[model samples]
Target: MTHTIRNLSTLVELRSNEVEKLQSEVAAKESLRERHQKTLDKLTHLYESSGASGRLPMALALNCGDYKQGVMAMAAHQKVNLSMHEADMAVSQRALTAAYVKREVLGQVLEKHQHAAVTAQRSQERKQHDELATQLWYRGHK
Candidate 1:
């Protein structure tokens, strides 16, 4: 397809839209990762603070121990989930970078096309003006 200023501008706009969508996707992934990390942190704190009292009666001691164990298991699971989210976020970030680069390149192409068009227009105008001046000079001389 011919790369006129209009066509190149359209391509640039399309690329820009794609970049924006990719950016939003990456941002959502990052936000999800942050929330997952926060949940993991909370799980860690819960695990750490769940220690059984030293002087509990037998039944209560056993119950406290069970609860602490459960907390540990949950924290372990949360850690794994956070790791998965991290991986997802990394993938999203790479995609965003690629899209951004594509958009920038398209924008540069559009800018170059616009500059060329303007230069051509000015050159054409100068030629016309020179021709008009020559016509006027010839008539005045006659």
Candidate 2:
């Protein structure tokens, strides 16, 4: 029985480690996604603030238009990349949640096994104590 408890504890520890690893992976993914979003925001801001004003000389306005077009294309690409990153992050999050649940279940099982082992030990001790008390009473009476 004690050996069984030991095996259970080992399993619980393994599950805990798995959960921690998955949590770190999810956090890393989340951080990457946030950075991509910031990049996209900056690109959009740049596209809007490009120097395409009516007061610009004709040649300069033409150059600004070309720059705007390039920025727009880059922004589109960035958005697609951001979408892919978000999808990956979502998958990682799901895996992390599942790991957390499995770890908790294992922990609960270990707790139950330990409690049963302790209870059994105390029961055995109580029986031995009761027998000793009865033997002393009988000896004294005789």
* Residue 89 lDDT (model 1): 82
Local distance difference test scores for all models: 0.84, 0.90
lDDT of 2 by residue, 1-142 (tens): 8998899899889988998999888888888888999999999999998865567898888888888989999999999999999888888888888888988998898899899999999999999999999999999999
Q: Candidate 1 on 1-142: residue-level lDDT in tens? A: 2358778888878888988898888888888888888888887888688765568998888888888888789888988988988888888788888888888998898888778888888999999999999999999999
TM-score of each: 0.89, 0.92
Least lDDT summed over 10 consecutive residues: which range in candidate 2?
Answer: 49-58
Give the Cα error of residue 17 in candidate 2, in Å.
0.9
Index of the highest-lDDT prediction:
2
